[model samples]
Target: MKNSITPSVPARGPADHEVRDQIVAAATEHFSRYGYEKTTVSDLAKAIGFSKAYIYKFFESKQAIGEMICANCLQEIEREVRTAVAEADLPPEKLRRVFKVFTEASLKLFFRDRKLYDIAASAATENWQAVQAYEARVRTLLREVLQEGRQSGDFERKTPLDETATAIYLVLRPYLNPLLLQYNRDTTDVAPAQLSSLVLRSLSP
Candidate 1:
């Protein structure tokens, strides 16, 4: 298969490493219930029935655990987008379908792990490094996609592709805003597909 723009994070070990996953699951719960600010190693260890020092053996701090949780969530989004783009089967339309693919993935990411999303948002609002890196990667991906669209005459925006992409990101950002998720809480109003369609059609020639 051809190389794709999927996000990959540092791998720890195997799928059968039950103990590591137990920590991750415990961290996920703690981060969800208490959020980044309030979640502590002792709390996570207590939740998992592990020792505080044992938690340290796997993760040095809450921030490190937060990174693993957020990284796992982001990785899921990347996999979905990669599958959509890879299976579109038409290079000409691959560029256009990427929007749908990415949007679909975003919806899944949003709904599949609201708790982790909340934790990530709390960290992001605090200006965490992993969140900043994810944001930059998002912008970079948008810039590249927009540039491709321009080259193929799919979009007519005259500004530099990166600037244009940034503008578009600003416009469509609220749909994925974590605050909105807090309000909706039930996932009834956020329609990532419709949002993606609106964006894709807006740029269609």
Candidate 2:
């Protein structure tokens, strides 16, 4: 008989945490200036004054680092959406606010930091965990809004809750998706309000 043992990985120490943050911060600046697709791990290493092997010790690949950045950006948008919805007095108003704040927040990102937007676009295209989780949270929010409307006698209860939420999410997908949003920018100014109105009308009790 032979005995086998697994090698245990060491826990990260304070210095390790500091180095990881340094790598991520430098990578963010590098990616912002150079674009995600254009920049390489070697480039980040050179810019951060670190060896490529050292960088890899913290992140298995460039995409892993990118995932963290993308998640942070999406979290920002989600926070804005939540805040806007929270300030509303009614389900109808909350739903409208979701459209307005979400579109505005996304556009702000796209226009303000296009390099970062490129990473988000890539995340959306690849169905990254961050994007997928964002979309799930959004759908859940929509369902909650619809439920509130029904309970308040503001929305029709005939439609299935999940179906209605899915439909609303689909309606807003063009504006929400980074890739689609670029092409849809021409209509961005007025589309969200108009679409929300149309959806709200359909939901009337």
Please give, for residues 1-205, the per-residue lDDT of candidate 1 as tens digits: 3334443334345534677778888778777777666767787788889998877776667777777777677656656655665575433355445455555555667666556667657655666555566656666656666666667677766566677677766654544345454454343344445555566677666
Q: Residue by residue across 1-205, what tens digits does model 2's lDDT show?
A: 0112111122233435888777778888888999999998998899999999888777778887887777767777878888888788899999999898889999998668888787888898998876777788788889988998999999999989999999999999998999999999999899989999999999999
Every model's TM-score: 0.67, 0.88
List residue ranges in candidate 2 displaced over 4 A: 1-18
In lDDT terms, how accurate is model 1?
Answer: 0.62
Best by lDDT: 2
Model 2, CA-based lDDT: 0.83
